[model samples]
Target: MVRRFGNGTATARAREEALGKLPSPRGRLPVIGHLHLLGSFPHVSLRDLAAQHGRDGLMLLRLGAVPTLVVSSPAAAQAVLRTHDHVFASRPHSPVTDILFYGSTDVAFCPYGHHWRQVKKIATTHLLTARKVRSYRHAREHEVRLVVAKLRRDAVGGDAVNMSDLLNAFANDVICHAVSGKSFRKQGHNKLFRELVEANSSLIGGFNLEDHFPALVKLDIIKRMVCAKARRVHKMWDDLLDSLIDHHASKPASERGGEDCDFIDVLLSVQQEYNLTKDHIKAQLTIMFEAGTDTSFIVLEYAMVRLMQSPHLMAKLQAEVRNTVPKEKDTVTEDDLTGLAYLKAVIKETLRLHMPAPLLVPHLSMAGCDVNGYTIPSETRVIVNSWALARDPSGWESAEEFVPERFLEGGSAAAVDYRGNDFLYLPFGAGRRICPGINFAIVTVEIMLANLMYHFDWKLPPRSGAGRWH
Candidate 1:
């Protein structure tokens, strides 16, 4: 990042000078630039750095060879994510994603362009539409039932159930049902999906030298070392997806289009319509599987962890769920989820406090744009510190506390929401790249949590304590 060439032209030098105006935290070192300013957790590091040196919610950092613009407050977020969304809506190229997602063809990682437009249209209009999400109600309910059954069998007589494993399995099974089909468990494919998702998450989430030092990957040794695991995981995914797609494709075309179709089936039926190659179809499904399984599981696990640490919140949520749900039903159905104010409040609070992706996916500026009186150069990568924005002391009352009631009627933040309308609480993000699976993810969480709360009273295991979980 410290490499400096002779000032070649007015435009190049001018752009460099403009970037200098953006505030940067102290302690930058040679070659690494601001990379050393970041600690073990980049989001926390950015939040602390932004507080000390940020100007007008904007801070600039040179992450190795790349120069990034960090937006750390609600106003700046609105300026970038809303006002100049088109200018900063595209994703930067990543070598890892390129291999895993078939040259970055998936909706989440694809750069902003015509292909992105087409796939996003297919997803929003047909694949992940509200009606389409509703169509998976039975499958979701069945998965919840299976979860309840497993908990009943495993947690008998003061045994401590591993909610982490249980919830992870539930989330995976739910996604499997949605993606592959009902009979996926006959040969333990759900377990395989879980393993692949974990491998992918760890590989992508961990530190990668190529991300910061792009030039190093050009060497044969560095390229092989960096891309070997990605290649393995991609093939694993490809083989599994190919088998499932072939199964769906083998069936007569006459029987394929309906509410019973899995995600793969839906993608195939519209392959010609969307001009999708088999790679394209597999790419979309891979991204969808990873997103669907990982996101819901993390949120659910964190919600349970937080609630266990707070007895009042737990009781409040349980009371609302048990009282509102009909006693005759064996499990809480999606229909029973309506009007459960506290349940929804708990979910909203969970999302606000523990956004799965603390940093919104990195966005690359397509053109120069002025934000909050500062000029951002074209091709500048932007990251919104969502964790900072949601928990800002200036914006939220009791910003550090886990208070779900704040989302209730007449509460301090009753008007705030996650749909990007309110910049302060953007768990699902805003604008064109906002998560298309919001409906799918939210309903999945609601049904499983509601059923878990209704069917059993949660507590710490007998070996650990005789008291309440807290």
Candidate 2:
């Protein structure tokens, strides 16, 4: 049932005619397109390319025979994310996401449609609502206590902890507690959860030839690794959800029917109402666990790195947090987070600098559409470069510098915000496809950062150059 279009056919002709209306590319390389110049740091390379090509630069990347379009400016991003959102809302099918996300049942990777909408609604209403996120304050506090306790012990001996691992563990614990009402550190635990978390993170960050070349998807060596990991993760998720469902079902109706319901309780209610199967519930839980844990960890890691590199910024942040939060408090409360303006600015800056998913997950055009005078054929894959847009000089001042002040009052940079309105600052993405966990993520990150700053003073390990802390 797969249909192929010929260059000389009417479909191609119509596309060419549509292309005539859009902004033309300033330049393009041969068969490889801009691949050679892109190298590993595609974000920076694309930024430079856009500077030379102009705001509406369009380039054809020969990602195999398919000419994938990479849009690098705010205007172009708006065209893709805002003006033509519906036309390009469907996700590009990938072997990793397809298998890991239960054939794209999750909110982040699901193609735009009824199924995606249903999944997103459940996430927003039951899992990521502000009330739901705030209800897990004890979990967040407990995990932060563990993180700080461990860090303090390590710092006592002047030990250099691989912050990456610590942060990953912190995020994983918080997410697990939030989603399952349990922590990975619980006694009598299985190692499957940790294994699946590691594998999922690796798959996201690891290079996969299959993403760019669909024809070679089955032939690629990474496919085997992906399948193995997927099977393991699927099994673990199935077991975990089965237990949660059973536990809730066993609970008296009085306990389960209360207003204080967890994610599992919410899903069960939905299942009964919609007459959904256990498999559907499992698919939803799997997506939430994998996506929630990995993304929050990535952002936290990036924030820590940026703070380490900018000591003055760190000192200022710490001072602000200490001044705002009392030492007697065992944990920083959600209300405390609101008063810490600088902390919010720091997080916003980190996200602006390093959006975890730089490409914002590719979307396929369901139907032919015209954007900025270019004709996009129906079924053509489109990628929105949120990473590039965040740093576009046109949108931000000194875009490369680590200046959190840009988000403060009266700063040169305007408050574009991240609530799906500004395409330039879409770290959570935009339109109907925006991430559903945005509220939960913000609360978790803000609370953690505030507590860390309030509780301790951080410094680079001895013998390491001061340059490490900048």
| Best candidate, lDDT | 1
For model 1, state the Cα shift of residue 193 in Å.
0.7
Cα-based lDDT for every prediction: 0.87, 0.71
Q: For candidate 2, what's the RMSD?
A: 4.1
lDDT of 1 by residue, 193-278 (tens): 99999988887777878887888888989999999999999999999988988888999988787877888888998899889999
TM-score attained by model 1: 0.95
Q: Report, for all candidates in order, the number of backbone clashes.
A: 0, 7
Question: How do the residues 376-419 of candidate 2 rate in per-residue lDDT, one tens digit apiece?
Answer: 77767777778888877777889878898988888765466878
